[model samples]
Target: MKIGIIGSGMVGRAFSIRLAELGHDVLIGTRNPIITLGREEPDSKGIPAWKFWSLHNPEIKLATFQEVADFGDVIINATAGAISIEALSKIEKDSLKDKVILDLALPLSYSPERSPKLIYSNEDSLGEKIQRAFPESKVVKTLNTMSYKVMLYPSLLPRQHNAFISGDSEEAKLIIAKIMEGFGWESKDIIDLGGIITARTTEMYAPLLFQLSKIKGHYNINISVVSK
Candidate 1:
């Protein structure tokens, strides 16, 4: 599958590398194309440089937002929640028409002291808002319930974790589920919590993940769904 990932942050870069490793044609969209060139060093976060070195497929090119929207068979929105709409707005509406967008962003807004909080509430979610804005695009919300480290490679961990996907489009959800399975996630491990309305619950997990990251001093944990 030809996949386009917007945002060059940890999540975006991580997914690009993993998907590329899995033999998928991956294109990364970033504000600055130089980052993909690997000319400069990475920040203290240890993400940017690592991704550049780890990418096995040189075919994974850095492209403009519009190029990504046009090039992808499936578009993955990995941008920060506050800027997700802004980023998508820059792309020509027609370019994303009838496309499947796998949304992994959270509705986070930054304040003075706090890190970020969900700008949306229980009544609405980022997924619904994006779907409303791009009615022609099928948006499936998934992979927001865990950290970037666990998003693709979970078997390395001691226990298996669960991920949730929600969207009104059954066809889109099935495609996302198959993609997830390719990335080392098991079918039984992923929960399809009905349509996009359930995205509120999935989005809410972001704040909880933030709190847990603070408590554990790590962002590599996962949420396991265990049946009794």
Candidate 2:
């Protein structure tokens, strides 16, 4: 499977390497290839520049946002929540036609006082916005509530945890669910909360997840749905 992932940051690199290791052709997309490749140092977040990371993993390739979107069988949005739509909008409408968009981004932003909050949550969600923006494509939301490490390596925690997926297209959801399975997520561990609207709750989990991470001093955590 050819997978195109938007964003050349840690999240995108994590998925690119894991998926390529799984025998899938992966391409990571960024805004400016020349500029991104020129940076020798890490960013404000301390993530290594794309050029350095690209050297270690030559199997996975890089391209501009639109180019990767056109090359992929399925497009994964690994971009930050604040600019996900802008990044995706770079792709032409025809390229997105009937394509399954696996969205795992949240609309996170900080206030003037540097307080964390969701740009769109509760009443609306980034998944719903992506669906609306690209009506021709099927958008499925998942994995936004957890860390990228846990996303590809669910077994790292060693427990019966769960991942949530929501989309208007059942077929699209199934496709993404299969990919999640490839990442070592058991079939029973994946929970489908119905249509794309359910992303409201999933994306809304960011604040709580962040709080928990702050308290624990680690981002490695999982959500388990217990039942009788």
Candidate 3:
């Protein structure tokens, strides 16, 4: 499958590399071509070269946002929550019309001292907004509840962790589930928590993740759903 990822941050880069490693053709969409080429270095304090190198591979190519949208069979949105709608608006909606998008973004706004806070209300969410904006596209909300490291490397955990996908389209969710499995997740580990409306709860997990990262001094933590 050809996958295009918007936002070249940790989540975008990590997902691109992992999917490519699983034999999927991956393309990353970045706001600036120079940054994608590593010509314009990212802030060293926020993202180190070694970490970037770990997520970037020779096989993954970078493209303009429009090109990525047109080229992908599935598009993954890994952008900052606050600007996600704006970033996507730059792309021609017709290009992504009817495409399956795996939305890993949360509806969070920037904060001076911490990761962004969820700015969306209980009645709406990033996923739902995307779906509404591009009614032709199918948006499946997944991978937002966990940290970037655990998004693809769940086995590194002490035990298996649960990943959730929420969307109205069953077929799209199934396709995303297969892709998730290829990234080293088991079918049993993925939970479909109903339609896109459920994204509110999933997005809320971002704050919990932020707090956990602070307490654990790590951003690699994950959650598991256990049976009684």
Clashing residue pairs in candidate 1, if any?
Answer: none
User: TM-score for each prediction?
Assistant: 0.88, 0.97, 0.90
Best by lDDT: 2
Candidate 2: residue 62 lDDT (0-100): 80
Lowest-sum lDDT 10-residue window in model 3 = 42-51
Candidates' C-alpha lDDT: 0.85, 0.91, 0.85
Q: Write the per-residue lDDT of candidate 1 for residues 32-149, one digit (tens) a residue.
A: 5665565457765665563455465465577888889899989999998888998889899899998999999998888779967889878999998899888999999998887777
Tens-place lDDT digits, model 3, residues 73-175? 9999999888899999989999999899889887777768877678876778999999998899999999888777788887778887899999999999999
lDDT of 2: 0.91
TM-score of 1: 0.88
Top-TM-score structure, candidate number? 2
* True-structure lDDT of candidate 1: 0.85
In model 2, where do residues sit more than 4 Å from their true spots? 111-115
The all-Cα superposition gives candidate 3 an RMSD in Å to the true structure of 2.5
Off by over 4 Å in 3: 34-38, 48-56, 113-115
